[model samples]
Target: MKSAMMEREGFAALVLRLRSEGISDINLLTAVEQTPRSRFVAHHLAEHAYSSRTIPIECGSFLEGADLAVRLLHRLRIGAGQRVLEIGTGSGFMTAVLGRIVERVISVERYKTLVEEAQTRLDQFSIRNVILRQGDGSNGLPGEGTFDRIIATAAFPAIPKTFTEQLVHNGILMCPVMVDDERCVMVRLTRTGSRFEREDLFEVPYLPLTPHIASYL
Candidate 1:
């Protein structure tokens, strides 16, 4: 019989799969496995929450690969004692992960219901480092000036120009840009002597960048 130890081994196996998908950071993997992803997703889909794939949540929003998100953030060099701003808080999974590693996080979402639900889920986990808001992410979080890091989970046309202005000098901005009708491109923007540079990564398809809250962000 496969005992609990074997089941734990299985969980490790899933983590290894994350590694294969370009998530090479050890701490990010641990956080991905440690966070109760199942708890954040719908109850009906909880069983597969740890399966290293995206799970559909309410409001048409989806929980992306926590492994990928963690890896991207790590590559961006996010660390303790810095303020970070996230544009999308779908399930609050990434928010929780960032909360653990960063000094503080201000995550913006457009859908009221999605924001409320994610806030409730994250609050249950006692993740106090993240601040949730309902707003237009495309415009960027106004009056929340000068973040040490800015990350957007939604797919956008390009890194919003406003985001570059909001980032502190020497800061980094990460987002998935739309390459065509459906393909997603991971865009990494790092400040260099007052300018920003971008690196495009693999394609991913996520919910659109809801410049306008449309009942589904």
Candidate 2:
């Protein structure tokens, strides 16, 4: 009983920190509050789940920092009725969060092990809206049909045109792109008719998005 109370307190504090960081969306905050991030992390690292720092997951990938994930999600302006495409599943924490906010989410990951593990976590949370697929997301999954929003968790040297092409008219795509040899910046692209409008959000530190499916874990 005491442990449950502590977990609740930790989540409450996390919500406050996100709000202080300028996350003003009530629904997003509620989703963040309700989702148990601990369930998405390794048992030994569960204590750090509610903290803002990234936690190592399987497949040599790291769950993105909570602050960074929330900031990006907020900027995407995700609507409850929209369908979102997530380029990286990571620990499935962000996938669960997006599942809570959107009507449907199709997340692709390069590692099959990560996909299976993430599916287990999502199942534990009873999140029925998310579909986890194992694939290379360097170029978005065009066969899944267009989405209302698309977000890539890894960094890219430049915006991949294939990803933008997969967006529905007026759909939004958020990603991190290398601005120089030493720096990566978060970028937002919105599809309008035959053109895409671009905006650079902020600098971020992320490994470049890997291409092709992993042959082994």
TM per candidate: 0.87, 0.94
The CA lDDT at 103 in model 2 is 98
Model 1 scores worst on lDDT over the 10 consecutive residues at 1-10
- Where does model 1 exceed 4 Å of error? 1-11, 20-26, 214-217
Question: Candidate 2, residues 84-176: lDDT per residue as tens digits?
Answer: 999989888889999988999999999999999989988988999999999989989977888999999889999898888889998999999
Scored by Cα lDDT, where does model 1 land? 0.76
Candidate 1: deviation at residue 51, Å?
2.4
By TM-score, how accurate is candidate 2?
A: 0.94
Judged by whole-model lDDT over C-alpha atoms, candidate 2 comes out at: 0.87
**Highest TM-score, which number?**
2
